[model samples]
Target: MNAPRSLDARLTEQRNPRTARIDQLATLEIVDLINAEDRMVAAAVGEERQQIARAIDIVVECLRAGGRLFYVGAGTSGRLGVLDASEMPPTYRTDPALVQGIIAGGLDALVRAQEGAEDHAGDGAAAMDEKNVDARDFVLGIAASGTTPYVHGALQRARERGARTGFLLCSWPSEALMKTHDVVIAPLVGPEVITGSTRMKAGTATKIVLNTISTAAMVKLGKVYGNLMVDLQVTCQKLQDRGERILMATVGVSREEAQRLLDESGGHVKTAIVMASRSLDAQEARQRLDAAGGSVTELVGTLPVA
Candidate 1:
């Protein structure tokens, strides 16, 4: 009889028949083959659209309740989580603590490979404790194989602490895993081009999912106005220019006037629009924005032509 198959024998770890002889392929052929494999990632993620949307709602709920969203993972999974978390503060002007990433090996692991760090379940639990995860917080564990001890331990401890937990896996997880997480996002990107190398397709899928979740949550929080990132912090020249452009396009103002409005609103595009539309001073515009939940459209009711 064949021996029992371990978790590594799962689909994500299995070989892809399409790229079986990739080593023998020409340079151009290899690129074409890799691109073909990448084409499937989006559709796989699309299949989990409902679950991804639900995850976003859970995150939004946690943030609205003054709680935070945490992403726990190891290796490539961990890196992607950190990348997404780090970008949110700059992109949306949200507090860094609002969205956090906890890799198994900590900051040092970010640069070098620390594969051994993922073995300690106790350490994973300790990280959750340090973060003070509670009922209001939501923690999402990213594990390509759905079997990372570090991720599993973190989610388990997070649940024990009354935190909402979710799991993002590249494989079809067992029934126990499905039951454990409040949300399970399985993109099922299938096997990698280079067998067992999850950093390829799995990494791309994780990036896409993280992007969608954070972007949607920010939108729901009114960090965006239509398709524009209105809550962006003007800490640099590029952002200042973008902010001015947003004001000019939204309110039909000249570049100079947009800069003036931005100055009045302390470089906040949303507040600048409110100030311009309602003929209010910076303080009154901020008050109206706060009252209207920082929604430019709601605060102004209707736009006024230049």
Candidate 2:
């Protein structure tokens, strides 16, 4: 089978007429060329906003039904997945298992090059099965080239077992690979800053795309409120302070009053908002939040404007 033309790879090719002086160009000229291509990364992602929004909605649905989100990739893509997953626990106070990342060379792949590990497509399939992926789950295989055997094999197995399978590739749509996946998201951010080093521009594009998908989906899942990460953990005093401030500003209560509600709600921003605005106590606040499906917007949405 003919390989798919790398849509990004084609676009990012240095277009200026090659000259004998090309080898003698100054470092700044090379930097300028790279900057030009890097500037297009955001535009590529922006063009796919609607598709990204759809992916977010689907991810939220999976999590709502007690499912997990898994990211499988090799090399830079794998490392990026690991980095994003690692941040979730601290940033959003979510369970570590809720969003997991599997790199080609296991945890070691995050740092050093895992040569040949990506070629083991069977390893990718094994990882998915080990995770016990279910229909309620979403698995996204990210590969800048769009033809990573490791990711393709995982997508194939993920589909066969009934999990919603998605692919994030930088290549033009290749039917051979696309047919194996359910959702195909190709944000063709053309090429790398350094020839084949996808870690540069391609990786940046993938990271931005992943961040958007997960964050937007979280918002849909009621994890965010008025641009605030309401689900942020109050385990730290700083977060607890932030929770108090959010409650006071959102509920229009005094600083002291918001702190009181925060203490009553055990530092829960959602509960504190409900308790302060609705004049309900802790238990009632929880009941109200639960009824609102954990959304502060919905609960306060019904109250008269202060």
Candidate 3:
């Protein structure tokens, strides 16, 4: 016979004393109570700054080595992971294969909740196998409650396949969990306003953490120059307009000249900047950028402060 799982030990599963009387409060009071609880979330995330920075370094290392990054989770965690991965291509001009998200119930679960999908550990391991995760790759598992069998299973297999792994949870992390992976990010956001409703505070913390990791990695990889996304490629009207504006501001060109440069550079913002700043043609600008390792700063100095 097996012992029963103790849900009480999980910080995310515990009832909050602060919101104990939330049900009896008026609508405005209820809103205030929830707001108060939400305020603590940022501080909790801040407490894990060092751990988050470490995770970013690992991700940068993996990407620089031509390895991919995978975010594995289930439920809200899975959805958040997928959301972060999907934004990389358009935001950073990265290949979609560079960052991936694996949910226990797969893509279908992304639109609709799939009950019991997180219970099967074997499925998680299979997902890692299907992705062909290797030593050069980095896999980060997200589980708010810190006990999701599926996430653990996937990370375990990822490690077995020689991939570096990390874990992100909203509750308190055990010592074993800290030592098991290269990094463990646990933002103790306390219990939710509705008691065990981790989708509130925990979800917010997870989103913030993912944003920091991916954005920092992109900036380090020269996808961003100063505060501008230099790697941007004009894919839509909005992006085309934005790219032209970027060139106008950075290269000291008029709108017409910016548009011409953009067209000449095939709508590549960084290449256009290189062409305009270095007084080079498109081909020469591309060669210079390639030689400088795609760093606009390496070709042209840093953007002047406004």
Candidate 4:
């Protein structure tokens, strides 16, 4: 007879020996224990740095080719994916369609727990088709457990549609999984403090990894100049203030000049910087930015080191 499979085979589901007595401890002790476990999350993510970098390269390539990026998952994983995607537009001024998030139970699943929705593999496959995934697109599935049926199904269909697919998990990936995806980022963050409560360390690791990938990709695409988010669109009072400050700092202009440039450039920080640095009108600065592939550094040279 074949040996029985262990129910606790997944690292995310296994008990953390260090945190076994957490429930019996005082509130402060519990907090300290959780914090101790959290410390391991960053190192775990660092261990997958190469895989993460590879994923970023794929995302940048697909995006540059006029394709979109999709993140698919369920539950906490899905919510995190959506959160990351939603920030791209305002942060980098990307189109809403450039990056998307597909949760197994859809938007309704975001706020409430749709635990049963993750079991339907068909729903996952259908989502890929609905998105019209293509060869130029990149799809990344996030599932800390490494065995979410919904995530697997979506990735399988995404691959079938000729899209480049990648997987991010908090557990060890099987050989088959390693061979199947274009890149597999497994940040083994160990068991959660409360057994399988992955929202703790695993979630932290996932957020960090996503942040690194998206931030690096944006930086490479020239959405940043000297570590500043120069590609920002001034949409609010806070952003307006930030845009003016960026202009003042990068273009060596006074507050009045910065405000004038900002208004002239229509609240675009990069355009304002280009207009001030190159001594060009808004129209001319826009033309130069377009010619330089939207790269501020290409037209104005690198920002001086502070």
- The Cα RMSD in angstroms, rounded to one decimal, for candidate 4 relative to the true structure is 3.0
Q: Is candidate 2 or candidate 4 better by TM-score?
A: 4
Give the alpha carbon lDDT tens digit for every residue of 1-306 in model 1.
543333666778887888888999999999999999999999999999999999999999999999999999999999999999999988998999999999999999999989999988888899999999999999999999998899999999999999999999999889999888899999999899988899999999999999999999999988888788888878889999999998888888999999999887888888888888889999998888888877776765544444
* lDDT (Cα, 0-100) at 210 in candidate 4: 90
User: Ten consecutive residues with minimal summed lDDT in candidate 2?
Assistant: 11-20
User: Each prediction's Cα RMSD?
Assistant: 2.9, 4.4, 3.5, 3.0
| Tens-digit lDDT string for candidate 4 (29-128) | 9988888999999999999999999999999999999899999999999999999999999999999999999998999999999999999988999999
Q: Among all windows of ten consecutive residues in candidate 1, which has the lowest summed lDDT?
A: 1-10
- Model 1, residue 8: distance off in Å is 3.5
In model 2, which runs have C-alpha deviations exceeding 4 angstroms?
A: 1-31, 302-306
- Which prediction has more favorable lDDT, 2 or 4? 4
How many angstroms is residue 237 displaced in model 3 relative to the true structure, after the best TM-score fit? 1.2
Q: Model 2 residue 12 lDDT?
A: 35
User: How accurate locally is residue 31 in candidate 4, as Cα lDDT from 0 to 100?
Assistant: 84
Each candidate: how many clashes?
Answer: 0, 1, 0, 0
Measured on C-alpha atoms, candidate 4 has an lDDT of 0.92
Best by lDDT: 3
- For all predicted structures, in order, the TM-scores are 0.95, 0.87, 0.96, 0.97
Clashing pairs in 4: none
Local distance difference test scores for all models: 0.91, 0.79, 0.92, 0.92
Predict model 1's lDDT versus the native: 0.91
